[model samples]
Target: MYDFANSGYTTVVITAVFSAYFVGGLAKGAHWATLAWTSALSLSYAIVMLSMPALGAWADLHAGKKRLLMLATIGCVVGTALLAWTPRLSGTEAVIAAMLFIVVSNTFYSYGESLIASFLPELATAQGMGKVSGWGWSFGYVGGMLALGISLGYVLWSQAQGLPASHFVPVCMLITAGIYAVAAAVTFSLLPERAQPRVDRGIGAWQQLRSTWQGARRYRDFVWLLACTVCYQGGVAVAITLAAIYAEQVIGFKPQETMVLIFVLNLAAAGGAFTFGYVQDRLGHRLALSITLVAWMAVCLIAASVTTKGGFWVAAAIAGLAMGSSQSAGRAMVGVLAPPLQMAEFFGLWSFATRLAAIIGPLAYGLVTWATHGNQRVAILATTVLFIAGLLLLLPIDMKRGRAAAIEKSPA
Candidate 1:
């Protein structure tokens, strides 16, 4: 539910409709403001990486993880709804408000994600964690698709009636917030809270967080998984951040066409997520991830070469498939490698790895576009290298043994 909530907001407000509205209508109608907006967003992600582990440690000490997640979601939803009023800002006001939105929303998302590792035990056995992760991802994509469809419907209706394009902004923001509220409610109602830890004065909060970091470093497989996640996840991040923009620029897709492509891709993603989850349960995480990586490599290559709308949709479909399988299996893999009593702490660090890289990926692609006079094919090629590298690095990890290690640490 958290994943669904976040995706609805991310797809509609952050990545698709509202961003376009902000770039064109807000910030006094300056498109260059997008760079500042994106930079501020990156800073938001950096803050999440820096603070989530500390927050996790505090939560562990106080048994307030669920409470914190609820607070974060409230903040995110409020900020998203408040975007309707942000169109009036200019100069520093515009930049600051945008930053606040990014920070609040992403902070909530990162915290919520930390709690997901807790679900691993209830949702799947060690052997079935991949499928469980896939189900979550599939739901996320479905949520995004639903939100995007609403946005597209609004766009088409407004256009047919000769209404302004920016008219959809407030509607999108409200829908995003509304969906997030639902997700949060569902999460609070359905998910079990982690038990409070006994007071142990042996380690200070900071000391415990440091110990978690040290443990991550000391665990060779964990370190390897982090490295793979950082690289390949960056590719996924960049692809998503730019896919629609690229389609618009390269294939001349209208918003309606773009939404269709997104829908098809996400549907494929949903299928791949569930299918790969089952595959991982049977064949294992390493194999499922390996398949996803290879599939992503092909998509990246195809995206680089393809120019037609048909070709773009094909690439999107492939990307969708890779997105679901890889992310779901990866989360499951992380669950299998995490310390049971410290799942939230470990997930916090893991979030830092993947989410921090997400900040880098888009900026890198934007810089590449600027340097090459809007050339993006090269960027696609470079991302493919990251995916391939991740696959190669993951090849050596023994998934069966990793699952055993996690099960051994879990409370019996």
Candidate 2:
């Protein structure tokens, strides 16, 4: 249920609706909106990357993961709710307000992901972690579909009533925020916190940082996983952040068409995530991730070459499949590799890698688009390179050694 609400925020606010509104409706042009959206993502990721390690370490040391998760969730909910007040592109002030809200909300959302993920190792055994993670992601996809469907219904109804879309966009934001808050509350109420062993309280942030740095040397395979994630997830972030805008500008998709496409993508992604969970457990994380990366590369190629709307839909389905599988495999790998006591700290690094990818991928695409006078096709093609690079890095990883190291290092 929590994943469902969180997925709603990502699909509706970040991926589909508000992103298009930011470029087409608010920023009033593709060029500025691209710059604004990427800039916001970059700034937010920068903050997350810098703070996550310390926060993760602190939460683990104090056994305060749940508390931190709650705090981050509240920040997200409040920031998302505030987006309801975004002015309808009347002027520069409105654009700035919208961007500010998105940045803050997105930061909170990222932090929540990291915090929640730290609990995964406690929730399931290594043999079953993939299935649990996959289920969560599947639920998220359903949430995404529900949120997008509601927003699409609103858009269709508003158009029928002769009302401009700008009037309904903010309402959609409010709905997303409400769903997230309510779902998160249910999760908080029902989920039990795992017990943590006592640790020395005198350990300072600097010591924690040094310990984490040293642990990286001890956990080389885990470090390799993080490196691979950086490359592939960078490409994934770019594809997700700009999919709607690309369809609208390049393929000439209307807002309604884009929503329907997103809805279908969510359904496909749910199946992919659910099915791949079994694959991850049977085939192992490295092999599963490699497969997904290949799929992502294929999707990028298809998206870049296809000129027809029908062709783009084919690419979207491939993307949805790859997206869910890749993310589920990555999280399961982290659960397998992280030392049980340091789960939060390792997941924090996971967030750092993901945030770094978020920063680099979007900024690269945004800059290329700006320089080429809004030519996004070339930018889209560049993402394939990231997937290829990630696959190369991942091929050398020793998943068995990584899991062994995690078990050896875990406190009894």
Top TM-score hit: 2
Clash number for model 1?
Answer: 0
Tens-digit lDDT string for candidate 1 (1-412)? 7778777776776666665555445654343444555565677678878887777677667666778888878877888888766655666686567667766776666667666555565557676787778888888888888888887787788889887654566777787788888876988898777566645666656788887666653466777888888888878877666676677666787766766777777788889998888998898678878888899999988989987878877888888888888878888888888766666666777888887777777667767666676677886777787787888889778765665665564567
Instruction: Estimate the TM-score of every prediction.
Output: 0.92, 0.98
Candidate 1: where is the Cα deviation over 4 Å? Answer: 22-34, 89-96, 404-411
The alpha-carbon deviation from the true structure for residue 389 of candidate 1, after best TM-score superposition, in angstroms, is: 2.0
Q: Specify the poorest-scoring 10-residue window by lDDT in model 2.
A: 197-206
Question: Residue 18 error for model 1, in Å?
Answer: 2.9
Model 2: pairs clashing at backbone N, Cα or C within 3 Å: none
lDDT of 2 at 14: 81
lDDT of 2 by residue, 1-412 (tens): 6788789988988888888888888877746689788899889999999999888988888888889889999999899888878854477888889888888999999999998888888889989889999999898899889888888898899889988767888888988888888888888998877857346668865578678887677799989988998999999998778899999989999988998998898899999999999999998888889999999999989998999999999999999998998998999999998988789889999999999999989889999888888888988998889999999989878978888988895666
Q: What TM-score does candidate 1 get on C-alpha atoms?
A: 0.92
Q: How many Å off is the CA of 164 in candidate 2?
A: 1.0
